[model samples]
Each structure stands twice: as C-alpha cells, then as structure tokens.
Target: MKNRNLIIIMISLLTIISCENSYAEIRWEKNLATAIKKAKSKNLPIMIDIYTDWCSWCKELDKNTYSNEEVIETAKKMVSVKLNPENSEEGEEIARKYGVQGYPTILFINADGFVLENVGGYVEGEKFVPYMKNAIDKLGKINVILSSKEPSLEKLDLYMESGNETEATKIFNDLLGKKSIPDEAMPKYLLGFGLIRAQQSDYDGANSYFDRIIKEYPKSEEVYMAHYYKAVGMILSGDTDKPKKYLENLIKNSNIPNNIKTQYQTLLSYINED
Candidate 1:
C-alpha cells in the first residue's frame, strides 16, 4: 500500500508541474532596467506585473489570468516583467514611481520609460488580453503622435479613449504648449483629470482644474460638468459656504446646461441651510 501511494504522489506532482509549465510560460524579466533596455532595443512596450507576497489577488492573477493562452501569447509580443515590490528595492521604487497603490498593478510602460498606465485589481484570464493589449495600443498611439510634426487632437482623442492619462498628458505638453488643442477638445480632458483628482480626494487640486475650465472654456459643454465636480469637491473639502454659493451662481448662470443645473440643484438647495 505504501509503495502504491508513493507512486501516485509522484505522478500527481509531475502532473502539477507539467500543467504549470504548459500554462504560464512568459519570459519574465525580473529587473525593470533590463526589461526597459530590452524593450527600448526592440522598440517594444513593457508590461509590468507589480505584485506583493501578501496579495491573494496577485497570486490568483498569476494562476488564472496570466495562465490564459491569449494573455500569454499577447504578453510574448512585449517585454514582459514580473516584480514583487515588497521583496525587492528596485521593484518598490519602480512601483512607487508609477503610483502603484494596489497589488497586481499591470503597468504598461513605453519604450521611453514612461509609465503610461498602472492598472490595478485582478481580472480573469479571458479578460486580461484585451486590457493589456489596450495598454500596448495606447503606447503605440502616443508614439505616432510624438513622431508627427504637428499635434493632432484627432490622434490625442485616440489616446484618451484608451484611458492612458500619463501618456496623453505627456503628448499634450510635448507636442503642444499649454492650451493648443481646440477649446472643445481641451476642456473635456482637463475636466476628466479633475474628476480623477476628485476621486482621489484631492479636493483643492480638483477644484482648481474645474475652475480653469469654467473660466477658459465657458462655452464648452464640459463647463457644466466642471461646475458640478467643483461643487462636490468643495463640499467634500468641508467648505459648506463656498460650494453652496458656487452652486447658486451656477444655477443663475444662463450658460450652464439646463439638465445639469437640474441634476445637482438639490445639493445646492441642501447647502442653503446657513
């Protein structure tokens, strides 16, 4: 019985090892610098898997998401890297530089060494390819814009659609000085960034951005959104008086869209207590 059980255990161990090898066979570079160098030499983007020892989601992402054949195949086309930021000094520095607040941050880095996007959270295998591929595509789109002689809002629009804010901002500043894009295109992006800041609880930062749009792009449809977000930020920042006055002013402004005014009108009403 002991001999039989030993033989079964050996077979199971071999089977598990073989299964693991077959699934996730990414050529993972541990060092970020080495990966960046390799990617730069090949004109390829880098895919960084930022993980930590304590994150169960990170382990699951490795076993389930990276194990997908499509994901593995897609990852092969780029300079793939895996790093445990908790365990390595280099990894921690890289992760911190990219705003990695959570484990399993799938960072897409351009060949120029810019972290275009640091997407967090864990996704399943089937959904992984498109997410990473979109990251790679953002780098390509940004590169095309940088390579062009003049800035193009149309091309920048493509980058925005990919949701790579880091790449978009760099391209915006590099190709066009401040406020180069058409007023219509410019305010929306600004407001989008403002919303991001607001979500991060940077109320002052968010309000500043919103105020810029309200002042510079009064005719823009985004101004209404800017006003709403600014009010929310102000209220969150504990300014009970200022945001109320701002919302009331927004209501009085004929430029604000009627629908937008109506949407947040209740919040404005609530602020009138004092």
Candidate 2:
C-alpha cells in the first residue's frame, strides 16, 4: 500500500512538472516576417513581445504578465509573436522604428502592418488587461484622428472630457507618437491631471498616470500631488504598502509645501488609525 501511494505521488509530481514546463516554454519567432505572414493569413492583428534574454523583468513578463488569463484570452484574437531584440535584425529594426529603447516592449500592430502602439515594461494581470482592452479599442479612434484634416488638442480634450476614455487615450498616444506634444513639465502635468480626473474611479488608470508624473517630472510641483493621489488610489485598490511608501516619501521631501505636508500627515494618521 505504501509503495503504491508513493508511485501515485511521483506520477502526480511528474504531471505537474510537465505542465509547468510546457507553460514556461513559449513559441518565440526569430523574425517579424513570419509573424506578419501569419497575421495576413489569419486576418488578425499582431502582438509582438520584444525582449532580451538578460532582462529579468522580461522573464517576469513572460512568466506572469503574458501567462495571465485575460492577456492570454485577448492575445488569442491576435497573431501572438515573441522576438528577442539582440538576436534578430528584423526585431531590431522594428524596435528602432517603434522607438523601443528598453526591454519587454509590447507592440500592437494593425492588420495592415502599421504599428499602433508600443507599450513597454512588465505589468501584472490587473493592469495588463485594461491596457490590452484600451489598445484594441483605440485602433478605430486612431484612424479617425489621423484622417481628420485638423487634429487638434481640443478634439482630444473633448474626447477626454466627454467620457470617451479609450478615444482620448488614443488621441494622446497618437499625439505622443507624432512628437506633436512636448514632454516638458507643463504637458506631463496636464496629462497627469487629465488622467487623474478622467479615471477617478479607475485606480489603475490613476496610478499609471501618477507614476508617469513621478518618473518624468520628479522636480515639478505635481510630483507631491501625484504622490498623494497615488497613495489614495493605491489604498483604494487594496495596495497596502504603496500608500505608506508614498506618504513616507512625501514626508521626507523637504521641497513639499507645508499645506501638502500637513494633508499627507493627516491622511497618514487616518490610514494608521485602524
């Protein structure tokens, strides 16, 4: 009886290991030509996962982000392809064309082979799902925006203010692509503000924009506000450590205004009360 039980356990362990290995080993294409050909044949959009072998975050994205259920389901609608930037000339060319300066860039290309968007870095399931959905939805609006004779910020702002978040996001992304908008203090600040207001209920959206603000405009006054808003959004989203970390950063930053410091302290106290 003991020998039989041990054999059963070993079989179970082997099965589990096989499944795990299968999931870990993804079908990576060497070049974009194959992906494009497949996309044309299948009449599907292409999703290219650009990475290098040495990138730890790239591995995490493969293991966690792309393995996510929603990501996998959404990817099924498209021609999924993985390319190593260092290994393939075609992949390198695509990365250069799309302005991918970093590893783990995910490019969503239209059926016609035009690069729609280039999203970089590792993102978990919750954040990744919304980004994919937004990217898919934005393609149509991008056509409209690009075809328009006068593509103005007003139109973009209207879309943003009118609750057409997907369209607004696309317009902003398009603007960024064309280099029409400056990445100066003012533009980043405005974009961050708009994202915060537009996605008040969307903790992930708010967090994303606030994070950009912190990264891009660390010296700007908006950083303090962004930190506060990020903390609030994180707390609401059940990210326990983020709120505390943001608060602590704000508290330590001597450049923060007295009123903002007071507010941060008050919020911190409130959070710690229970």
Candidate 3:
C-alpha cells in the first residue's frame, strides 16, 4: 500500500510540472503574412520579434525579457510575431525591408501596415519596457497623423518653410526618437532640413544634429545634404580644416545624388577661391 502511494505521489508531481511548463504562455508566431493578417483582422499593431535560432541573446530575450510581466502585458495588446531570419522567407523580407542586418530585431508596425520602428539587438526588462512604451507612443502618433484630414507631409513642409524651425525640429525629433515615423526619404530630408535651420548660427549645435542624421539615417536621401551642411557649418565656424576631410569624403562617396554632389562641389570651389 505504501509503495502504491509513493508511485501515485510521484505521478502527481510529474503531472503538475508538465502542466506548469505547458501553461507558460509563449506568445510567438511563425510567419509575417499570417501575423499581419491576424493583426489586420483584429485591429492590432504587429510586433515582429526577429531572431536567429542559434543566438544566445535572442534566447535570453525570449526567456527573460519576453517573460517579464510588464513586457508580457504590454505585448498582449499587440499581435506578436516571431521571425527566424535564417529560416523563413517572410522573415527575410521583413529583415531586408527594415534594413535589419543583425539578429534580434524588434519591429513595431502600425495598424495601417507601415513599420513604425525597427529596434535591433537585446536589452534587459527594465530598459526594454521603456523602449516598448516609446514604440507604442509613436504608433499612437501615426494614428493621429492618419486620422487628420489634412496631409501630414504638407503640414510638415509648411512648418519647415515658415521658419517654425523649433516646431519642425520638435516634430521630426519626436518622430525619430519615438520611431513613429516611416523610413521614407522625404521625412528624413525634412528632418535634416529642420535640424540645419535650428542650428543655423550655432555651428556646434548644427554639427551635432547633422552628425546624428549621418550616423542614424545613413541611407536617407538627405545624407549628401547632411554632409554638405556639416562641412558648411564647420567652415563658417572657422573649423575650416575639419570641413575639408568631410567635403573630400562627400565628393568620394559614389552613392550621393549627382545634383547634391554638384552643389557641394560648387560650394567647395567658392570656399577655395576665398
């Protein structure tokens, strides 16, 4: 009878452990298409967790970050999708579209099917929660832009042209910081323009903003403009020597738009003449 009781107790303990593991909620999806479809149907934002199977950091994010109560709760409000970059075509497409060159890329896509943000690599729960919140806030802003009857781009341009540099800078900076804006050429152009205006007479301030655009938005259409402006700012501030190297780099960079390159070259000629 005692042996029977021991066997029964062991069986009950095993059952309880199995149940606990099984009940542990792992919010994951296999494919982008399916995830998108579900998000669209349910009117939820899409959160893509880009990972590689062999990545230890990726596993840690899954085990610790994703399992954190705050992260899990916040994540439940959106459609969660997992993509293994090494295995799936859908995953590869998302990775390529967002310029995700490395593992553990977290993408937050707004309801209208536009990518709001692309966060790369791993962070712990404390840091991760704020990141997610910021992404969510950006998603909210996108919704506001979409709901407005007036065109957002036009309003943005008006703000820029009217010399409301502070407001324009705020909007763009907010968008960039929040990851609420799309990875479009036009917005980046406007952002670079706004930053230039804000630092018009302040070379140090201007250089900092220009450098940020260069470092963070390398593929932006405004890259040449950023380079040119950086050189101009440096030159105007009597930091002429530093400008020469960047000007040379701009001239050498084959990817720069032709018209912009010509503009920079013209400016360089003027600087040399004086």
Candidate 4:
C-alpha cells in the first residue's frame, strides 16, 4: 500500500509539471486602450491586471497564479492587459475610475466596457481559476443580452437571470435615480434589488427591499416572490422561527404555484430536521 501511494503521488506531480511546461505564457498587453480595442475587434472579453511596481503581492501573482496552467489556458479566451497605476497618467485615471484601491486587482470586462467581475486581493491559483471562468461565463451571457433589442428593464432582468449582478447593480442604480418609475415595473425592480442585496449578504438591506415589494406592490405578481425571499433572508440571518411561521402562513393561505409550494414545504422540512 505504501509503495502504491508513493507511485500515485509521483504520477500526480509529473502530470502537474507537464501541464506547467505546456503553457508558454499569457500574452499580456501593456496599454488598456489598445487591449480594449483588440477585445472589441475580436469580439473577446478583456482581463485587466491592476498592478504596481512596489507591490510584492503583484509579483507573487505573476509568479504563482499567472503561471498556473488553468489560468493561462482560460486567459487565452480574452485580451489580457497589465496596467501599472503609477506608470502613467492614463493608468492612474483608469485605476481611479474602476475604484481600484488595492494592489493586484483583477478586472474582467466585457467587450462593451461593462465590468463583469472584480477580483480584489491576492488569490491562489486554485481559487483564482474559478473567478476567471465565472467572468468568462458572465461575459458571454451579457454580450447576448446586449445584442438583443430587449427593453431596458427587461435587459436588467436578463442580467439578473445570467447572474451578472455587477451590471445589474449599475442599471438598477441608474433607474432608481430617475424621477418616476412606472408602477408596473417597480415590483420587479425592487425584487431584483432585494436579490442583489441578498447576494451581498446584507440581510437587513435585502429584507428592506423585499418589504417594499410586498407592501407597496401587494397586488403585483412579484409579491409572492418577495415573501419567499424575505423568509430566506430571515433564515440566513440566523432566525428560522419567524421564517418558519411565515412559510407556514404562505403555504396555508397563499395560492402560489404547486411547485413553489412544494419547495416551501421542503424548506420547512429541512429546517425542522435541522
């Protein structure tokens, strides 16, 4: 058994080394503007590394994370750019625009200039690979949404469906700034905002939005979902009793879909089991 274990470990090490040797390098662009232009022309997404000369973690990222075979392979699908915030005025301006306060900030931007994801701080190769994959997945979905002639609010819904909260938040905030939003759209808008806040782990903020949807738009189609999410937020906030009662009430009195009612029942069973 000992000999077999040793052999297995050796084989794994050899495979890792082979993968490392196969990828040459990620061809990194020096200028952000040029990288963006190439990405737009080629219909590719952009990956920007915001680094500084004096940042040790930045060098470590180049040495460790960037050298990972998976990261190199994934980076090939996008236009990669490296910008030093202290190197030029343009770099400084762009860094400020993106709110890049930390060193070695990685930004994945779609071809149309919307940031798909922002990864802050130093991350290991194993963890960093997933962030790149998520950004790429979001980029594809956002591009499709952008090309469609969907109405602006519907586009926001599409973004939420695609799990592109960064873009959705931008549109949501912009719409909120408007003097008046049609009553027909307000329930959906509030629900979307609540979902975003929930994703951010701000249960209080999320519940506030859900409350608005339930109270202000009681007759709207989104009210039932608002009730569901509010219960979820309460559950996540470490209080299961209130949500349990709320779901019980919903299950008894609400005319929600059978499938949704089943989901609520399952949640209640799981909560009871816990």
Q: Per-residue lDDT tens digits of candidate 1, residues 1-274?
A: 9999999999999999999886567778868889988998887889888888899999998889887888888887789888888888878877655556888888887766555556789989888787777867777767777687665675556455444567667767765675667656778888867865765677888888898998898888888788788887888788898888888877887866688889679788777764
Show model 4 residue runs off by greater than 4 Å.
1-23, 157-274
Q: What is the C-alpha lDDT of each candidate?
A: 0.78, 0.71, 0.71, 0.81
Candidate 4 lDDT (Cα, whole model)? 0.81
Query: In TM-score terms, which candidate is top?
Result: 1
Per-residue lDDT value at 154 in model 1? 56
Clashing pairs in 3: none
| Candidate 3 lDDT by residue in tens digits, 198-251 | 444666776666777778878876766677777877787776667777777788
What lDDT score goes with residue 260 in model 3? 84
Off by over 4 Å in 3: 1-23, 154-225, 228-274
Off by over 4 Å in 2: 1-30, 140-274
Tens-place lDDT digits, model 2, residues 184-237: 635453554445453546677677677777787887777777777777777767
The candidates, ranked best first by TM-score, are 1, 3, 4, 2
Least lDDT summed over 10 consecutive residues: which range in candidate 4?
Answer: 149-158
Clashing pairs in 1: none
Q: After superposition, how far is residue 223 of candidate 3 from its true place, in Å?
A: 7.9
Ranking by lDDT: 4, 1, 3, 2
Q: Model 2 RMSD to the real structure?
A: 14.1
